[model samples]
Target: MKHLSLSAQRFPRRATSAVAAAAVAFAFAGCANYSGISSDKQIAAPDKFEATQSVPGQGGQWPSLDWAKQFGDPQLPQLIDEALADNPSIAQAQARIAKASSYIDTSRSALYPKVNGSYSWTRELYSANALFPPPYGGTWYSENNALVSASWDLDLWGKNRARLNQAVSQEKAAEADMQQARVTLAASLARTYNQLALLYALRDVAQREIANRQDVGRITNGRVAAGLDTNVERRTAEGNVATSQTSLTELDGQIESVRYQLAALLGKGPDRGLQIAKPVIDPKVNVTLPDNIPADLISRRPDIIAARWQVEAATQNIKEAKAEFFPDINLTAAFGFDAFGWSKFLQSSSRQIQFGPAIHLPIFDAGALRAQLKGRYADFEGDVANYNQTLVSALNDVATNISAIRSLDKQMSDANRALTAATSAYQLAVIRYKAGLSPQLQVLNADDNRLANEQTVTNLRLKRTDLQIALIKSLGGGFDATSTNLAIDGSGQQQAANPTTNQTSPSQ
Candidate 1:
């Protein structure tokens, strides 16, 4: 009995000593091989844009809120509003954003633990004298086993984190792209709406021409009946009326074609309620536009920001890809109970456990790893180039639009003056003809000149409006003086993230 008591005490001490030694070993193992990521919070974006030319610009301020309200046409506002809401391209951009966000979530999943469960059952018959023969009686009994295992790749190399960062950057890029698409769509819809308005105004002019020709035809027929006009003269007047009416009919078809395009922009069928009302031409609209936009407004552009974010994502990808050259460390372990009998499975003596770390260093695989690194490096270079290009394009767009707006302003003034002169001439010819002082052909020619001049002026107005839109687009689409207050100071403001360019991320 004493021997048994002593044995029990000795066993407990031995077990305790073993446990203490194992814990120390584990602590030493865990403290090994530590590394840190560099926390340099500065993003090195490409240099900013600088225009090469000193171009002249209209000096007056352009109205903010991108005011189409100057047209005083309620229909213009309604069409723009409805198109923004129902445009399929806008919806597509939204979907891209959502899809990219989800992909980012997927990329981030690597930061967490990974667990797997597996089970198996195997049986085999062995001939006599085989290794251990058949375990029990007969050929073989059922062999059943199950394992619940888990593994986690420690991000000591920052590979997973870098990948996560890349995804985040891409996601931000996608957001910018989506916004850019929205502005582009809005700009397109506005431009088409204005085009339709021009067609309506031009149609009205054609109708006036038709009315004047009809009046001349009636006068010539009356004169012919009174023996004061030759048959050839009356026929000539009727022929002019027919020619004007034909031109009017042709223009009417062209006008409907523009309306159909507007309907499609609104995502409706040809016969849908694209009930576009005519927009009135406002003769009092101020054509003077601002030319000297501030240089620091580039960041507000969705495309520019999107390109910047693309650079960020590419930068993170290069980091992640470069990390692949280093050794990847993985940890795997399991803790469970195993026993020959089910009753003993819970016993401490029946406990089973294992743990280990694995490292994979690139030795050689026919230069595949090096090729990957090179490829990623090339990709980084490409991203840098793309960013520079985007910046340059943005700069050129603003400069060109500013120059155009100024030139159009001058031309529009000249056109209006010409139109006024033509109107005076047309009125004078009408007075002389009524007093029997001028031939009908002279009156007809003067009125034709006036009508043509008016059409030219109306076209110039529409052209100016279009130029306004272009200037607005060049100014980064609705971004204005207020954006100067929200300066991007290059302090990793957006580039430091792991983003997914799912904002349709320049999807190349």
Candidate 2:
């Protein structure tokens, strides 16, 4: 068997040379070729904001990745783990990453060659009806034939590679996007669980009120039976008991609803509740903000980093597009088996192969290719805007959290003081009423005030915890912005764990 003879032919060689020269010139032109999105020049971050990879700040403690573990509550860590493992949004983001990665390979693959194989058989004869037969129409002869051929598109202008490059850029953006999704999911789960914990604490306060009011009812009934209390006094006691009990029922419903929400976030059914313990009542949260760019925040936020990567990817896309204005080169080569007849398919006489190259020339497409390049350039311009927006969003998150932390700290303290005062005032009022010195209204007012203050304290604590999670997420869940085109760490542990998890699943 003879080996396949492959030869490449370049057409319009002069025209191809001119296109190559144009590509180089166009690449330089694309350097500033603003297309769309309100052409803003590419510029570095403003001097005020510090880059993430800066040096350590005053105390020398960089942002901690163990941020979640800092919550002394043992249940928090477990909930976060489950959310990360099961959250459906995270799974969908992971799927996108996989899809983009495969597309990248598909585009890049064009840089190489493709191979194909085939088999066929044919026989012909003419019986007194052939115009070019040996006898010009008598009973003619018959013959069998078999042959094989192959062709390849020669990449004359690097067009195929340009498309491949475009795909590579897109894939890179997708990877960063996937990481951003993980951070958002984790933050969501942490915040939802915090809400549930606060509900549990509030329920405790409601139950206490119910018990105290029920005792008042029992004592008033005794006085009424002994003929020492009027019907009005007994009725008032009954009303107090009813109000407290009503409050307790509503609080219980709230707790159950929150628990169900938590279960859903963990990708589980309502019937199968989560095992997260009630949050330990902590008056204050210790969140340390990084002082300078080098400290951690600049680097840690995922959305900001992902946005920046998008800009870079867009820039590459522009480059790839500009490369398209010129001719493209492609190489297709194949080797396999072809047989006209199965009996002789593999035989020495029957074995055959042939190959050659073909080139593509873009004479004119009415500026279609140029417009495509311009579109990519325009998209890059938009990416720059998105990058700036992300940077601003990150800054806003930090600023908002700082204010929330301080406000909650003050609110929680005030609530505790109010609760203490209300309790003491209510006790004194009860004694005065029994000794016939003060009206019972005073006691009822104080009791309601104390419960309200207590519930307020729980809610404030939960809000502070949630704000902390928000701040952490805004920083991108501890991702490094400077690392790009570098090997992504993790098994794509960021990869979707369950294909169906995103199907109505909510994992972190």
Candidate 3:
């Protein structure tokens, strides 16, 4: 083995001292003065929700993470858990978090010295006439070298610190993105499950209507044979039966289509959806809305939080770009041993060391650095704008869903009353027709009205379920950034119910 010697010299002692003093002074002068923009002032949110205030017993409480469980469906949480484990979007978001975390490591590397070690061996033969005239020049020699080197870029202008900050912010954003994906997937599954239940309910209605229409057709046929009714009445009755059958067929198709959609969401094939049992949902289940929801809590929404993180990352980027306009100071050191023969490699006389400071002053580059700084600032402004838009859109979604849920409550009540009255009217018409006090047309008309009202009532009930799901989603679907890990463990085991906690708001 042989060792390699290292040597470095740039400035004399006095000159080096002066340069160090000057660098210190420049570093103090170049301290970052620009503070980032605040999303709080840029975006406006209402202090309290207006639509939810009218709901009794709401008490302005934040929604629970087990909001879906309020429907008393044992299968919903299981389905959501399966989707979270299997959904490709959720996996992708998790991958992004991993990538961003790696980036944080990359950025943090700039704050510490980089050290490397190496070992090498070389064998060479020299020509007789190159350096010496005789056998000395013709001799073959082997050399071995071992070396270790280190370098560090001093973060005098906070450039490296800014980069690290940017990476950390991006990592946080990625985490929020993961949480957002989970929230979205859970909500989608809940909606799809509810839709499936609605379809089943509608299918029952269609079957009943078909049977009623067929009965009307049979009665009309009997009256026609006795010359009490014309062929026109029989044909009309037959037409109603066909219409009801057609409606049944359409509902079946819709049911299958929704099943396939749900299967895809569960990360399974369409055939798997057919194996799912019909959902048993109570139409009377009413979801309560929170009264006086605080505007600040909107910031807890994952999408909003993700957008805020982006703004923070952009601010750090601007600071990094600004730091590039100042001078850079770097230090390097190397230690090695050089020897011609393997036996002498570890000798003290062969040992060597080298150390120096390098300074980089950007004297000229046209306007590239300034332009870069301007671009960074522009990006920061754009991020701020995006953040504001996201905030407004989030608030709008909450408000709109709240209003819809309230409206549905009233519509559902009206529909229930109308259905009951129609049912009574239908029974009266049937009794009158059997007694020969009313024409068959009157009974058929009443039957059609009852069927129509029944369908309306079912539709209203489904619509209310959909609206409640939407409202829950708008309220962040009970997703809490602090409880993300507990809510989604990715294992088949049941996740812990998300508990309420005070979450740190993003810096404005």
- RMSD to native for every prediction? 9.0, 9.6, 7.6
Candidate order, TM-score descending:
3, 1, 2
The alpha-carbon lDDT assigned to residue 302 of candidate 1 equals 72
Off by over 4 Å in 2: 1-40, 43-66, 126-131, 135-158, 218-229, 274-277, 281-283, 293-298, 330-357, 481-508
Which candidate has the top score in lDDT? 3
| lDDT tens digits by residue: candidate 2, 23-47 | 5454334322223322334623544
Please give the CA lDDT of all the candidate structures. 0.64, 0.60, 0.72
TM-score of 2: 0.76
- Model 3: CA > 4 A from native: 1-15, 18-58, 127-138, 230-232, 291-294, 482-508
lDDT digits (tens) for residues 303-390 of candidate 1: 8777767767776775675566555556667666655535665677766666555455554456565566556656666675676677
**Superposition-based RMSD of candidate 2 using all C-alpha atoms, in angstroms:** 9.6
TM-score, predicted candidate 1 vs. hidden true structure: 0.79
**Residue 488 displacement (Å), model 3:** 21
User: Which 10-residue window of candidate 3 scores lowest in summed lDDT?
Assistant: 492-501
Candidate that beats the other on TM-score, 1 or 3, i.e. the better one: 3
Q: TM-scores, in order shown? A: 0.79, 0.76, 0.84
lDDT of 2 at 57: 31
